[model samples]
Target: MTRVIVAAGGGGDAVAAVMVGAALYGAGEPAVILTYAWDRLLVDPVPGPRGPGDFTGLRPLTPHVLAVPAAAEPVAPAGSTLPRLAAELPHTFALIDPHHGARGIARQVGELVDQLAPESVDLLDVGGDILARGDEPTLKSPLGDALTLAACCRVDAPVRLLVAGPGLDGEIPADVLRDRLGAPVATLAPEHVEALGAVLDWHPSEATAMLAATARGVRGLCEVRGAGLAVPLTDEGPTVHEAGLEEALERNELARAVLDTTGLAEAERHSREICGFSEIDGERRRAARLGARAPAGLDPDAALARLDRFQADARARGITHTTFRRIAEVLGLNGTLRLDLRDLLLARRPEQYEAPLWRVPAEV
Candidate 1:
């Protein structure tokens, strides 16, 4: 079903509106209609040529279009007397306001919706400046009540109140929101603006909620995948390859495996060069022989320590290591460091170890 997102107050309101629009578009929905209300004083006057005989200075304009809508063909405002502009941009839409009070503005928006009856509509009400006085209620308590009532009466589709910034004050409390709205009430994060560029690619429509949920879910998964590859360190260092380090290294085929997955030909060549300099194969063979002779006394912890020392030596020889924390988290590592060593073996470059194992694209 198509849903209407109503953004009430602050900079966060704008962010929420943009996100909601992007989510809908990502779901392959039609363009959304965005309407913002501000105090009359903040509204700029439309400039015109002044006549020599005119006595009054430039008259204050009631409402002005701050931004054109982002749509193929924007619907003109009801009872518009101005000339219609041609649609030249993909995200084009209209900016409109009522010359009267807040109630009058709401009525006008309601009338517009009634006229259009779009499959879905979203009303983003960025709260007016509190310093200014007008017939429209302040965004805190009264405005919230008015909007709730308006949505209940006017819009037949799902209506959501996206409250952010200071406007959230005196409105519904967090605990009460679920009982009151009978739907989800989400908070807007201040950092959302950083992702605006990625977000604009999305188009708003009926399935906006689903798109948002999916994006959030995928990000969570990626984080889980990245966290699984971290090797734990103890006071004595690594605890896995002390006694049979050489044999374990040969059996695991770490070098060959890393070269295969990373897809970095240059890095693979570098690793091979480093391996030759360190004589890793010969060292592993000697360790394996020693391990075989002392098999009865071999300690797993000591073996791990030896592996740690080997890794340190490799690092000292200018060998780079790539850690993939984010990809591990996304892979759902349950605090376990049991990584599939094959991934590292196949990686051609150290950086390839950090790359995501799964091919999920990042969306804001």
Candidate 2:
């Protein structure tokens, strides 16, 4: 029977999903890993869902079914998290194009389901925010998870929704998640922690926070500041919990509202209707404006000057930290090059620059 594992949150979730899959299905179980090209602006310079045109070459597995070639390199310079997964996992990794929105994406997923005829499909979310009712004050980037969840509901395969490291993403608090989750069937032990740690550096933030909290032996009411401010966390044994996909949709008001969305724009509109505001969308607009005016080639001296002004503006707006990725986006630096520049700027942090947002105030 064919089985598939999909990351509810892109980027690091893809890495975390594999860890969960291995634990449940045994190592090297030959499951297709499905993720998206999008990532948080904090993690990638080019934020937001990328279009099919952005990909250099995508082999069509079936009609309306596009899969990333084993060695496909992104057409754009924005560092994509998908390629990393593709490189590490080789032929097993595929990316979903969310540009088509909820209904379009669900159709693609249906095509995949039809081809594989999978006996079961598991949608794995690193954080428990997928369970949020959309009114949570801390909720940001709910569109991706909501869109994926809506699409999952359309699949004929029996689907299982599992959330790991509850509240680690700093969106939904652990206590909140616990109140909703009856109990977890599996807990993240030291071995699982070790396996996760091996690849934790690849995708930082939430994944790193969970690993650190587990290592410190901190549980219940822990705090993580990666996503924003001092977000609460719960040790709760770093467990992975399972829930019926249908029941999960029923509980999430926003998910249910957008389940029938035909496109990305419609999904986004419904998201704003339910959640009130979208920080990810706002940042995307700013990044797009920045990219539009950005020079084709970067001048470090000029770029740093712009960043200095940006820091001042952020401070004026009471923004604590600004990620190097955001700076790269504003400066219009391309993929690997932006990462390279970040390393150099980080090496010169404190002495040359100062910002509360820099993870390491004193060191890179």
Candidate 3:
């Protein structure tokens, strides 16, 4: 039977869901993962999640649900990483349309559960943002996760909440998450990281990259992408914890607030009313301000100098680990240049980098 995993938040959560399934079901089994096509600002630049209409060649699983196969591609001006990820990951990638909000998501998931007949239904969030209380000072992107949690609560099947790399997203602190996460159901090993293969090479998810690095035995403080948030990496980083769904609903003020929402705007309104901000709004502003375009290929010496200055400041702040995405951003590179930065950096100073997050290299 196929393993059904719901990738709770978009971006790296999709990759994390696949890793979670591979750790539990093995890489050979065909798994169907339901996820939003939402991506980082640099990846989509359009802000918010892409729906079924955003892409071409989507096969219908249910009238309300669609499958994102390897052949599927996003129409121009609305970029996506899912289509490329579908081609790379072995599991079947399914799209979650949030335009209609939680009610629509629940209906879509319920129909998918009936069709899959899987051994278990899992809602996997890379970090423990699924359990956000909605008022945490660090919470930036809680609307999507809250909506997913609210929708999963309405699904007919028993959906398990699998939180991997707790606090790695820098949404909620690890100490705050420890009591909330309870005990872990599974600990991802190096083999599970291996299961992801070369996906880490190009994926821009700082949290999921931390998940792979933590599983491979890296530890300590990681300065994540966005706002220089330093998250403490612990032994529990690679473990996937099964949290109480009902209790999660109770803790998530925004999830409960949006449980009955019928539109994305409605849910976002609730998020702003509760948390005082919309993440997509921020993305829109950033995209407008940057109007990002591909720059000339990296000048190794100049890029190395940039890293040296940034790393010195970050090191002063006690951050030892970081992702290539953050490094590229510091160098004023866009989403497309992140991998190029990674490739160039690793080729020059392989000792400074690890699979996901890397330790700052000694100054060039």
The clash count of every prediction, one per candidate, is 51, 5, 0
Against the unseen true structure, what C-alpha lDDT does each candidate score? 0.28, 0.65, 0.85
Clashes of 3: 0
List model 3 lDDT by residue over 1-364, tens digit each: 7778888898689899877887877867778888989886767878888988899999898888899888898887788888888888887888999999999999988988887788888999988988888898888889889999999999888999889988888888778888988788889989988877788888788889899888999887888667777877788889999899999999999999999988999998998899999888888888777775445567888998889999999888878788887888788787677777888888888988777777975452
lDDT of 2 by residue, 1-364 (tens): 5567777867667777666765676554666767777755544557576666777667776677666764566674655656555555623666777767667767777887889887668888877878887888878778888878888898766678888877667678777877667567666655544444434433444553453445345433322333324433345636788866777788788788888877767777787888896656786786787567644665678876776775565555445444454566556565455556666675655554222123322222
Clashing pairs in 2: 77-335, 101-264, 219-235, 220-235, 321-357
Clashes of 2: 5
Model 1: lDDT of residue 30? 36
Ranking the candidates on TM-score from highest down gives: 3, 2, 1
Each model's RMSD to truth, in Å?
A: 27.6, 6.2, 1.7
Error at 130, model 1, angstroms: 15
Q: Least accurate stretch of 10 residues (summed lDDT) in model 2?
A: 355-364
Model 1 TM-score (2 dp) = 0.30
Which one is best on TM-score? Answer: 3
Error of 1 at 213 (Å): 15
